[model samples]
Target: MEYKWVVLTNTTLGVIMSSMNMYIVLISLPAIFRGLGINPFLPGEFVYLLWVLMGYSIVMATVLVTFGRISDMYGRARVYTWGFVVFTIASIFLSLIPSNSGNAGALLMILLRIVQAIGGGLLMVNSTALLTDAFPPSERGKALGLNQASFIVGSFLGLILGGMLVGYDWHMVFIVNVPFAVAGALWSVLKLRRTPGTGVVRLDLAGNVTLAAGLLAISLGLTYALMPYGNSQMGWTNPWVIASFPLGALMFVLFVLSERRAPAPLFNLSLFRVRPFSYGSIALFLNSLGRGAIMFLVVIWLQGIWLPLHGYPWESTPFWAGVYMIPMLVGTVIMAPVGGMLTDRYGARLFATLGMVIMALSLLALTILPYDFNLFEFELILFVSGLGGGLFSAPNTTAIMNSLRPQDRAAGNGMRQTFSSMGSTISMALFFSMLVTFFTMYVPNEISSAVASYGLPAQVASFLSSIPASGLLFAAFLGVDPASAIPQSVLSALPHSVVELLDSRTFLPSIIGPPFMDALRISLYISVALVLVGALFSWMRGGKFVYEESAGRPGEGRS
Candidate 1:
């Protein structure tokens, strides 16, 4: 077999493993909490839940650029192999975590996940550079397409795979990654060559510190901003959350200044001068921002609303939600390679712009559906969105990679991944804030009225109405019954029929659906607008331009 094929296969495997880990724990969180003997909904425990969900991504975002620069200074293949080793070891520890260890177990899980994220960051920052190194310019689009397709497919598959594995035991979810990681590590070590670096060994200490600090602050703020503040549905007003953004921005400004002065900068800000690289990155950020939260929204839609309203039990909703999203996987699988191959022939600009346009239209289509939307309609819209993602991802990534000089590939790819990751983090915070805002406006009255009509006492109704929107959404997200949060004494005092109704799967969904959909429509509209702007930026990336050392600056002469 050819060396390029080996690179492709190994890199794809690494990406799949890394991407799957991101979502596997997400879907299996309920089971994980159960195994830990902790309630995620309890007052102090919510922080643990937030950390578990956001920690990996935050760590990945913070370190990607640093890892990328390190790969360039050392050797891409060597650093990448080390990533597999670290990830494999972390998976082993995660799987063996003692059950019923309570908060200690949850903290241990979070710490291990942070370690896993470090490995994932290494793989992500260098994989594209390695692929770009191995493949010819003409074939890079197809190579990257297949690699990126695995990433998206793996994330979706993780949802289903987690649901399946967690049914028997939550430990199985982490255990499943060990064999793959071990094989990948061994394969990487034996087959991959360590390409020589730029020979400039000095590290950019200032740049690294500033950039990492900035991203860390920003990520933490976004994560915590999803929590409720005093008398508010979200924590946007919290002094810590409020301070984090400007401080992060100030740190970023300092990072830029430090980079300009550094002997060896972590990020090559000059690369932004390349039109395709710059425009493609902006488009990528916008597209990611628009689509990142769709999975969470759709999952909540299925698990919290549609499935329950249609009589599926709450415990089964998480698994079935993954099953229903199969059409999206199919769409991505079919379109990603085709889009990449076609971009190689016709140039990335056309395909990428068209993809974002399709994305905007599909997102717009979703807004027209009622809360009790037709299943076929929902699936069809999701499939279309997936197709748009497939079409855009490979070509856009190919364009950005192709426009960079060989020496700059790792750092450039790292910078690109940073944008994508940060966009996703911010998107989750932004969309969730929007949802919670709408929930605050509508849910309290809806809950109070529903319970009142059920003949609950005024105090009971008041207490139910006062339940925080974030808690309710988290309950819905975890596929736990909302009534589980009620005090046992209160539940026992309620009439038998009312108690039955309160505990039933349909009750929360019935009242929550309308408010959720109202928020969802507004979010969809915002997504449409974001994607449309992304399409415009994609169009601005101009014609196909591949960098060559002799070709002068990137946009001067097309390869």
Candidate 2:
């Protein structure tokens, strides 16, 4: 198979657009919530925030394989073109944003964002399949590596750009997509070639619906689980959480059975038959999981704790936080394609394994740092982690895609994407859970003791504790000073000394530093374990890309 630069360019554009859409809302979230007059840190608000952030991911994750399968059957360019159009329309609607200052307005944005996610799913599902088809097997690693780098680079810039755009106008975050989406859509209509599927199989609509439902249920359950439950810190024990998780899992089991029977399965379970494909996918899952939560964690650390502590105001936290995150870009810029080139020569095992080890070391590095850590030390660590991530991502993705039969590229790419997306969303949930659990078990006591140390009354300290841990939690998540997110009434309830204590940068940092650090440590170990295990799987994704017979006779399998 001959690979063209045009195909890579188009695919890279798709990757950038889809990925940028993911985090643009992230930096714009605080501003968006504020515009809607919603207290972003309030109880139940995190639900909206999570959806706006994860809804696209969930939709993409759920439908990616299905869409990929459809693209294979319907012609990849057909699905690809439609996705660009749909995504653009959604972006327009989001920018208009009927209202954001009230409950109804907020709900409108969420629904529209879900629409946007559907479009993104289409784009993401087919783009990799398209790229894989265009590139030869041997060159696929470098192609995928560069594509992966483009994806992350888009994300990296999205964080910084989103912050900047949203700071000036929240709507700009959504509006910014207009030009690119239009160009991509028009270009696809004019330039993208149709490559149709080979099989005469039927679409497994039932399997698709079941699996999508199952996955959506899990996401919904996990999302709501972040909310508060009575006097507890989080709603993990809530009925919705308890019921949704099991129901989703059960549906997934049923989905498996249905897939085994389906003639044209939405996800070709047979892809797992290849050891390298299966194992590489796991490593991809781990790679995403290990890195996913760091953005939120780092954002909180910078916006909520460090930057504010250093004198950046609450309103400016988002932009400055992005500025502080520049090191990640530096690392990826230098390492991603380089890693892929190295993988081309040395095989994927040792280099990919080392990358994960580097990531684990980086996580350990972050786990040990103080709340108000030094910049150069922290930036260096972030860059190294990004380097590792860049190293792992492309070669691993290349191996997974190349391991598959040419006919199965769609399903294969989709499966890899699903696992990676699930890993990210799950990582977010896990990190938040760990962070909140630690806060719940210890923050009250610590806050109380701290308040008491500041000579506050017992009643005042207790009242402060009663005002939902989520408020302060989001305060930290949003990088806002806790005093700012608090309700006027709650502030009134607190003693003069306690309010003063809570308002101080040092107070929140001093009290939160230890508990949050504990959570970070646990999260670090989890990431380390995942990366190391992923490295092993990446190693096992042995041999060079061996093309399927269906990849024409010219399918290049070796460098």
Candidate 3:
């Protein structure tokens, strides 16, 4: 039992580490770009910036199912352990990126992020399966709950940790993972036992390749779409994004057919045959879409709007933003174990439903927070929302994993993870699109007015306006100093008053406030709806994790 606990703990820690880094880049973006001495506002570099942020999620989404399938064929622990190794190595490589100028530094960071994504995919794909093998059906919820808790907790902490470290140095974002990675690797090798899987497993090469290619295309398209096209603040009209949609869709369609025909499929189509698994997977996906987007959006809102407007220095915003976010993390940590334990005894439906309901209320509450709101009011709501998500995650995961047959556990978990990955990736594209659209509608006039107000030459105002509001929004949102992102030549020529106005927190937020609020509120409405939908599906997931011809009773090997 003690040994099993060790295994679960190490594995969960690796997962947490892998996932935490996913969004750490968001808070640290300002520092990273500044460290690299790159102009974030350059139109061409916008795609790279978006890619650096979304690349890991994109890669994870593309490969999670394939890796999950492969893990079942070999060994879950074997694959999971390798993920930690690869992740650790990748972290070292990522940390080594020196502050070179131009595309070299940017490209290096994006490429390293892609590699980290691969490692993350390996870890997540096999997570549920490995836990399924270690814990009994009944206890799977609580176990997975704690694991799920770590994921969310890691996500929230990633922002906080990024703030703390990035102010000291941007490389700290990647370097911090080293000790955790090494520890997880050492513990995994010693503590984890292999649970042998059944059947003659042949690698589904075609299925894997097609699905990966399809998802990658979509991700690439979406990442680029965040760039400015022509005079547009966003690139929705880009030919590449337009063409890739059909191509990716066609490839994905082929992937499904290939999966159906393959003798040993990467994605076992049969897992969806189980009612609880299917519904639970769908609910998890929807909630994740809404949840994931909000996480990024909120960070932007806090750092871009609230934190700066509240008087924190641009460099100080990252740390203080993370500090303010403590309520969310603390609340999640406190609720996870209790929620998991409850799901073990009471089943997942009630808690998950109520939890989603709580999530809905929290989103609605967030809509009312002022751009420069009082901390106490905002923190109180963030804590409640965090608690709500904690409640929903464990029970929902418990139902999904426990629904499938023991032999199909890996595949089932993989499918669940695949849906989840899609949700998170899609969240980035959708949220960014909405925010950029808002930027276009709301920011141009304010910027033009500010630019002209400072007694700048007409050509200079024209030039600054031409740089694109999306770039400026990204700069502010990431907490980058306006002076750094813009050209020094332009800065020096511009009147002092205009420069200060352009640099001021009040100027950016006021211009962005209305439209950003429009999108933010609408997104919250969608989130509320999604949580309700998830709750309904969770409720439909039957009463218990009934295992027919299973390996062991609930809590058998679990500590």
Candidate 4:
């Protein structure tokens, strides 16, 4: 194989490994908690869950720009090779953690995941830049398309693989990454050569600190807002959340100022001035924002409500949920490479715009579906949504890379990932808030009615009604039996028949389903609007444009 092929294969494998690790952890969370003997709903324990879920992405998003810049100043290949080593080490550590270790084990896993994120960030920053370096503008789209497709496919496989492996042992979820990482790392060391750094090597301390701190504060605040504060459904009013917003905003303001004055700026302002780069980035951000939450929401709906109602056991729903989501993966796999090929032949604007339109239409279709939707209809809509994502991701990425100078590609890709990572973070926060707000509003009535119908005491009914919707959501999301969420005292007081009725698989869904669907409808509507806006941005990015570097400026003579 050619050297470029070597790079592509190794980097693609890296994408597969890293992305697979991420989604496997996501789907395997219930198993992990079970193995650790941790109660996700316990006070302060939710924080651990949040950390496990979001910490890696948070760290990756926070440090990627700096790492990308460092790779530019040092050598992309060198940094990338080390990334594999670090990621593999982290995976091994995670897999080795003892089940009996309790909170210490959970904390260790989070810390190890942070280390893995650092590695993954390095891989992500350089992988596309390396491909851009290897391929010409005419073929860049296809190469990146294939790369993007691999990422999507990897994520999908993780869902299935998590189901399979976690059924045997939760540790297998992390353990699966080792062999692949080792193979990739060895290939990287043997086959990859260092590409020399461009210009002067300088690190911007002020810019780095401010950016990391700002993003961390903001992400933490958003994540914690899923918890209750006082009598409120969400902790948005909590002092910490309140204080984080202004503090994060102030830090970001300082970061911008520092970037403007720094001898070697962290982010290049001139890159944003380029029409395609700026608009393409914005479109990508919007697409990620619109699409991120919907993926998890679908999983939750399948695992928590739909599958259970259809006779799947609560503990078995995680695996089946992934199984049901296969259509989305299939659609992406089919479209991504084709979209890339088309973008290379034509321009990205039309294809990318059309993809977003399709996605919006799919969201609209989903909005009208009942909580227990027709399986075929649900799968069809999922396929369309996946197709749209596949169509947009690669071409948008290629366009962004094509519009940057060789030296700037690392930093440029970093900028792209930052937008994406931030989008995912914001999407989760937004989706959770939306779900909690509407569920809290309508679920009390639903619960009260159900309890009263079951002839439970008013005190028992009141207590159940007053329990925060967020807790119920977490319980469902974590695949806990709904009856398990009830206080033991309440369960003991209830008649045996009432207990059985309340504990039935369909009972929780009946209580929460209507409100969940109500919230989901609004969320889908918002997603439609967001993706349409994204399409508008994509259309405005103009024709296929490639940058050529000269005298430290890019795209100067290309047009």
Candidate 5:
């Protein structure tokens, strides 16, 4: 392989491991909690679950821009190489955590994950800039396509790996990454050479601090809102959650002010003056907002409702859900490269706009499906959605990167990542809030009637009625057997036949499925609306533009 190819391969491996670790932890959460002797359904446990799932992404998003600027100041290759070492050490720590530390163990894991995110953020911020440096403008899209496809596939494969590993032992999920991380770190060290950074760089301490703190507060608040508060099904009304919004907003305003005053700002606001860069960013943000949480929604739908109803055991639902999702990954792999090549030849606008439209239609189609729809039909639509996402991702990213000058590409890419990450963070909050809203209104009454019909006393029935729908939804999310999660005292007092009826797989799904479907439809509708708006922004980007032609370009206005 050529030297550029070596760089691409090593960087691609880093992307794969980074993306894979994210989804693996998500799918393996149940087993991790089991291994730690924690019940995720319990009050404080949900908070731990939220932190484990959202903390890494939050840290990555917050640091990406700052790290990108740092890479530009120093050297992309140097930062990129160190990312591997940091990520490998974090993985070792995660896999070797002592088993008996309980909640303390969970907190330690979250802290270590933040370290991993710093490494991943550095890799991501530098990877695109490095590829752009190695390849000509005409070939940048193709390289990015392959890199993105690896990441998408890694995320999908993580689901399968997590399911398989957690079945035997949760520790396997972390341990599996050690060999790959070690190899990638060594390869990067020996084979990669540093690319010279832009000369005379000045650090923007104010911009970095304000932006990071603002984003952290916002993402943390939104993530915590997924858990139940004292009386509300959602924690949106919690004092801390309520405070985060204003605080984040104020900090962001200050960040903008600081950036404007800096000698050379952390974010070069001048880049947004490029029409393609501005519009493409808006489209990417909206597109990510619409699409980011779809995977989580699908996992809940499959693990909680479809799999169990279709005769899969609770313990096995996570694995089969991953198996069923294979078609989506296949679609992404097939579309990404083609889209990138086409964008290189023609233009990104058409492909990017059309992709969002297709994704919107897929969401609409999903909303109309019956709760127990045909498996083939479900897979087909999921494939369509993934195809649309893949088609959009490469070209949109190419357009944004190609619009910036060589020296500014790293920070530009970091800005792009910031929007993408913010969209994802907000998407989770939006979907969770919507689910809780509908579930709270409809599920409590249904549960009360279902338990009452099973010959339970009014007191026991009232207790069931009072249980928040958030708890029920989370129970389903974890693939918990609903009857088993009930208090042992109540179960002991009940008749044997009643206990058997409650314990049956049919019981919870039959009761919860309707309300769950209702909430799901609302969330899908929101997604459809968001993606259509993305298509509008994408279409308005107007014409092909590449920075290589900037000095004497036909579409100079677009650039």
Candidate 6:
């Protein structure tokens, strides 16, 4: 087999494996919490849940650029192979976590996930640079398209795979990655070779420190702001949250100053001067921000409202939610490679722009959907959204990589990946904040009215209504019946009819559905606006331009 094909195969495996880990744990959270002996509804336990969900992303966002620059200095292939080793080892440890370790176990899981994220960051930053190096400009898009497809497909597949594996054993979720990771690590080590002309360079310690610190502080702030403050729905006014933003901003300013003075900067600030690189990156960030939380929102909608209303049992909603989302995957799989091939022949701007426009329209359509939506109509919108994502991902990526010189590829791609990762993290924070705010304002009354209508005593109604909205959100997210958290004493004293009503699949879903839909519409509207703005940026990326072909020619870099 040719070396380029070797590079493509290995990199695609690495990409898929890394991306799959991001969502595998997501769908398996209920089982994972059970195995850890943790109750997710407790205020203290909510911190653990947030960390589990966001820790990997936070680490990935902060470390991507640093790893990219390191790869540039060392060798992309060499560093990438090590990534496989680190990721595999982390998976092994994660699977070996003691059953029912409680808080200790959850903390251990979070730490190990951060380790895995470091490995994932390395793989993500270098994969595109490796593909770009192995393939010619003409073929780069197709190769990148396939590679990008693996990432999207892997993310979606993780949900399905996690659902399957967790049913048998929660350990199997992490264990499944073992064989794949071991094989990929060995394959990459033996087959991949470092590119010639690459040489070691000094690391920009100062720039790296400031950038990492800045990103960490900001991410930490965003994550914690989802928690309730003293009397507020969210922690926006918490002293720690309030302090983090300004500290992060100061660090970013310091990072910029350090980069300006450094002989070899961690990030090449001058790269932004290239229109395609800058604008394509902006579009990528906005597009990611728009779409990041949609899956989570959809899952909550399915598990918390839709499936229950349709009479599915609470315990089964998680898996079925994954099953129902298959249409979106189908749409993406059909369009990603085709979009890439066409972009190679024509240019990235049109497909990329059109893709975002379609996404915006799809999201706008989603905003009008009633909570009790037709399944077919919901599936159709999801499919269209997938199509838009498929069309946008590869071509947009190709444009960014194509705009960079060989030496700058790792750093450029690193910066690009950072934008994408950070956007996703920030999107979750923003959208969840919106949902929680709405929940606080409306859920108590809704719950009180619904339970009272069932002829429950006023004290009982008040007790149920006093349950924190955040706790209910987490209960819904985990596919657990929210009524399960009520004290056994309270349940024993209730009339059998009231007890039955509380346990019924329809009761909670009915009460929460209207408020949930109200919050969802607001989120969808923001998503639509974000995607439309992303479309504008995508259009601004201009005509086809490949950096290698125009390196020595004046005015050739501008497309």
Tens-place lDDT per residue, model 5, 51-156, is 6756776776667887887887678888887788888888888988776568888899889888888888888898888887777778878988998899887888
Give the range where candidate 5 is weakest over 10 consecutive residues by summed lDDT.
550-559
RMSD of each: 2.2, 3.1, 3.5, 2.1, 2.4, 2.1
For model 2 the local lDDT of residue 268 reads 73
Question: So what's the TM-score on candidate 3?
Answer: 0.91
Q: Give residue 509's error in model 5 in angstroms.
A: 2.7
lDDT of 3: 0.75
Q: What TM-score does model 1 achieve against the real structure?
A: 0.94
**lDDT score for residue 415 of model 2:** 87
Candidate 6 local distance difference test against the native? 0.82
> Which residue ranges in model 3 land beyond 4 Å of their true spot?
152-157, 195-200, 231-233, 448-461, 481-495, 550-559
Per residue, candidate 3 scores C-alpha lDDT tens digits across 110-188 of 8888898788778777777777777876677678778877776677778789988987888889988888888887877
Please list all clashing residue pairs in model 4, or write none if there are none: none
Quantify how close model 2 is to the true structure by its C-alpha RMSD in Å.
3.1
Q: For each candidate, what is the lDDT?
A: 0.82, 0.75, 0.75, 0.81, 0.80, 0.82
The per-residue C-alpha lDDT of model 5 at residue 344 equals: 86
Across residues 1-559, which tens digit of lDDT does each residue of candidate 1 receive? 7999999999988988987887777777767876787754453355577677567766766678878877877799999988988898888899989999999999999999899888888888989999999999889999998997888777776878987887788898888887778888888989999778666577778877887788778767876776777876567799999999999999999998998988878777788889999999999999878877767687778877888888887666657877887787778777899899988888899999998998898889988898788999989988998898889889999999989988778888988988887677667767876787788788898887787677767766666666677666666656666556778888788778777777777877887888899999999999889989999999999998888767765455474
lDDT of 2 by residue, 1-559 (tens): 2246777888788878877777677766667777776664567676766666666666666778877767777788888988888899989988887544566777888788778877887888788778877876667767777887787777876888888887688888888777878888887877788765554557788787887788778877776776787776578889988999889999899889998988877777766767667888888888778877777787777766787668776678777777777787668766778777776666666667777778878888888788789999999999998887777766676667666676777778888888988788777766776677677788888887887677866665665576555566565655455666556886787778767766766666666777777777788888888888888887777676565664543234442
Residue pairs in candidate 2 whose N, alpha carbon or C atoms collide under 3 angstroms: 36-100, 36-101, 303-479, 304-479
Better of 2 and 3 by lDDT: 3
lDDT, model 6, position 309 = 87
Report the C-alpha displacement of residue 537, candidate 2, in angstroms.
1.3
lDDT of 4: 0.81
